[model samples]
Target: MLTRQEITILQELAKQYAEIASLPIQKEKRNMWLKLNTIQMERPMVLIDQIPWHEMDVDGFLKTKVSDPHWRGIEWEMRTAIYRWHHMPADLVVNPYICLPRIAENVGWNLPFHAESEVGQYGGQAQTHIFVNQLQEMEDIEKIQPRKIIVHKEREAEMLLEAKEVFGGIIDYRWGGFSSHLGFWDFISLWMGVTNCYIELMDRPEFMHAIMERMTQIHLEEIRQMNELQLYDINTNICHCSQTFLPDLPKEGDIAVSGNAWAFGLAQLFTSVSPAITDEFEVAYMKRIFPYYGAIYYGCCDRLDDRLDIIAKLPKIRKISCSPWSIPEPFAEKMPDYCAMSVKPNPAFLAGESMDEDSIRKEIRRAIAAAKNYNRSVEFILKDITTVRNDPQRLWRWQEIAMEEVQR
Candidate 1:
């Protein structure tokens, strides 16, 4: 139940959101994104997501006044959207709708682990952790099982009804689903420690294949159930922290399936693995599921410069992440022109004691030059931002610089 003050605050934010959504720039940006995604260049786009909100305290701009935990989340989202537009709008499309996700309970894949991390100022962000490996031997592979997704349709309807009652006329509300981040090896590293997994990959090659095979089947079943239930949210504006306003998704008034959306896959843990090794383990399994989506966004923090050829083999490969660790020139030269290069600039530049404005500008320019030299479509995605030394203005300034450079 929302209090009167909470309702008032949300209502005001919704009105502001509606106003922003109604802007002419929103449609223009949407068209630009569609062009970029389809390999028809319209100029590069820039987006800043995966921000460290805990470190941002700009005159209490991110603080929430709402009391309830659930409503507080909604309030925080509304505030963040409005705040983002004011600071680093950067090709973002402010939608006129709020999404209510279906209530789901996932069972199976009962992998156990014990992990420890230091609690500090930026505890909410990523930190160094010590994990206990749960999978010890090849025989332990039997423990993994296909997950069962149970959606509570009645409860989902009730939540949607409540949201409609709150902001029905002020803003539209729709049912949204989770975007796929299907990385089997990434999960395996958590279950079986990174060192152990790598050793097994070299020594017990058969065991590694068995594990990959099982993980692939588990994910396929999970996605199939989600598709059958029509729980996949393909109507989203963002997919894996990049613009998803392409012309080929979320079929109108039809049940949403994996085929109607963009699916994200990566092997961040396999960063040190050779191209052939990655092909056998990561790419082979991921390819099984890649065909299920309308398009695929592959790679993450991993440096994929060597495996561009291997990654190119996947079906519907639309975009590939070019992490900060990757050399822009080589990747740009080799990447398929059909795929958009999702360049992830280093967030460390913002985390320094003082902002390195010159380096930041140079880095963005380097990416731009590389993409232009190869005639590849590109988008600057500033993400995995762990911190800004508690200075929100650092990120704001970076966004300003990114937008200026991309436009030029």
Candidate 2:
């Protein structure tokens, strides 16, 4: 149930959304295309840690003095690394917040509180408990049940309003994963540990599926609530989702992540796994859960180029992962239209190369030159990025490159 305040705000916002969403679908498509271009071309992403998720001294952020008035000049910092994504040639993921599930652990599952980067830095179990030997014992797993007042409600609401106020709508407070990004796999690896769950899959197949399906339902409900509230329609650039495997499609009726649509992550993950393994256990599953997100990337944060032909069949996918090792040209040629490219650079370049201006310049140039012929507009994401201690200047290259190209 929405609060009177929420209803009032949303009713007003709904009028704006109707105007926005009513723009010709082609125009919206063009807008997204332009946005994708902005990602690949213009505005260097300045990954601002606009929202510090480490149990923010929320009061401090809310009350702190802001002397700088310009949007570009607005002063802010984060507990963890945040790139100025607009200037950098990459996707802008609002830091620390992207890893929401881990953060929420700080507030307990039932409360509406979010997990802070402090909590994420520590991380947590995919499935909280391990070795629950009894069937009924499994029932007590962590979940944020519906129909209850969420905790941290005040913090979250306050943060949202503050961001909107200061940023003048530039700060996009996206509601990302509150549960597992991986469908059934979230519970298996989280609770049982990957190794333990793998063995159980073969040793106790039916039990494993039941547990995975159950966990998936809990997770789906979480996403469903977010979707119902129009939370998914926030200023988010893309409805981004990823996982390890994919499932095969089925002929007839099957319950999907949403009402009738299967989840895309499952389909992509299946394509990544070896054919023999998929044929035995995952083919049927992927076939059913292959239609949710508009854009999907699969496989080990690596270039899923090998899986492209299979993935291309996904009508809604608009972005595909391009790993450092993946051959860019062929994959670029192969990705069916509308699928933007997500390029995963070798993190070694960021850490290994000497942090001289020339070296950083060359690295950015080489990446841009290499990605010149990509299937769609490019997205350079640095996964496992940990350091920038002495290389603050390095972040500027991506944004500079995109700005230079877009103008040309």
Candidate 3:
């Protein structure tokens, strides 16, 4: 049973959430996303994610009142969602339901790696870490193990029951599988330092290939197990922070496969790697997994301007990320018509002591002009926002600028 304070807080938030979700604009935004995802021409969509919430305490709007840990988490979600909608609702769709995952523990994968970091003064989204290389030699690769998913059905049932008790009458509650993003090279870099990993690609090519092969097998097995356990969440509303409300996905009451959902792939560490080496190590392994998904969203922060041709060869490729590091003109000229360009403006502009509205506007306008020239569907995604200099107004103003540019 919940405390009276918890009940009061959650119920009030649920009612407000339900009211906002019931608005006609929610459906309109979803339909717009569907059109954009399906390669149909629609106005560009703008999204802001990876916010530095520790700094967004405007008049104590983000301060938590609940005492229970679980309730505190739920409270934060509700507060942030409502805050974003009110302040910068750029193509954000507030669904009418709250989803709790089927509680599961990841077992196996015995390989361990460690890192050391310096955190920000406020201790939230600002941090830098240097990974210690754990996989130091070829022999160490033998220690790699397959991962398993161990679902706690009883706990999931209990949580679902408790959520229903709190939110049943106010809004819908869904028990869903965990949504995941898949990228192998990033993990490899954590195990082997980035410089060492790059050296291995050149000096120890066969060793790198063997490691990739093993990682591929491990991931494929994990995906198969999740499918067997019915733990794949195909109805997820977002893919890598961009909307995923496409029309081709399986509808309600339909049996879903891994292919019925979107798969995300990236090799951010391969930013400076040559296309041939990338294809040999990254694309070769990723392609083996891409066939399992109905659609693919690929790349992050990696400058893919020269590598678009390499990326286009992957199966079911629907969207490609164009980071601030990438030259927008080359990407815009060469991107496939069917694939939407998920443009990420530089978050550094927001991290300054003050907002640089001019730089932000020029960067966004450049992307817009390039996309329009090629008749490409564009989605402006502002992510990796590690700091706002303790000023939430900067983010709010950034959103205003983004929406203004996209709308124009």
Q: Please list the Cα RMSD from the true structure of every candidate, rounded to 1 decimal place.
A: 1.7, 10.9, 1.8
lDDT of 1: 0.84
- Give the Å shift of residue 383 in candidate 1: 0.4
On TM-score, the candidate that comes out on top is: 1
| Superior candidate under lDDT, 1 versus 3 | 1
- For candidate 3, lDDT tens digit of each residue in 1-408? 468778788889889878888999999999999898887857889999888888887878778888866567777878888889988889999888875666677675687777765455546456556777777677888778888889887876777777977897899977555554667888888888788889888899999898989888988898887777767666547778888887757577755457677778999888979988888888888888989877788988888988888888888888999998988888999998889999999999988777899999999999989988988899999998888888888889999999998887
Between candidates 1 and 2, which one is better according to lDDT?
1
lDDT of each: 0.84, 0.40, 0.83
lDDT value, residue 334 of candidate 3: 95
TM-score of each: 0.96, 0.52, 0.95
* Residue pairs clashing, model 3: none
Q: Which stretches of candidate 3 lie over 4 Å from their true place?
A: 65-71, 116-124
| Each prediction's number of clashing residue pairs | 0, 42, 0
lDDT of 2 by residue, 1-408 (tens): 234454344334333333333335424333444565333433222121212222223233323233422111122222122223223423333321211111122222342322222222212211123343223234533342333213355555664554455334322233332221433454334445445555665677676556645544554455555445323222223333322111222113332223322233432333344544443444334343444432244433434555566656544454566656766677667766665566555544544456444544454445555556542555555554444433544445534544454334
Candidate 2 has an lDDT of: 0.40
Write model 1 residue lDDT over 34-147, tens digit each, in one string: 899988878999999999988776778788988866567677878888899998899898876876655787787888666754454466576556667777777788788779
TM-score-superior candidate, 1 or 2:
1
lDDT of 3 at 131: 75
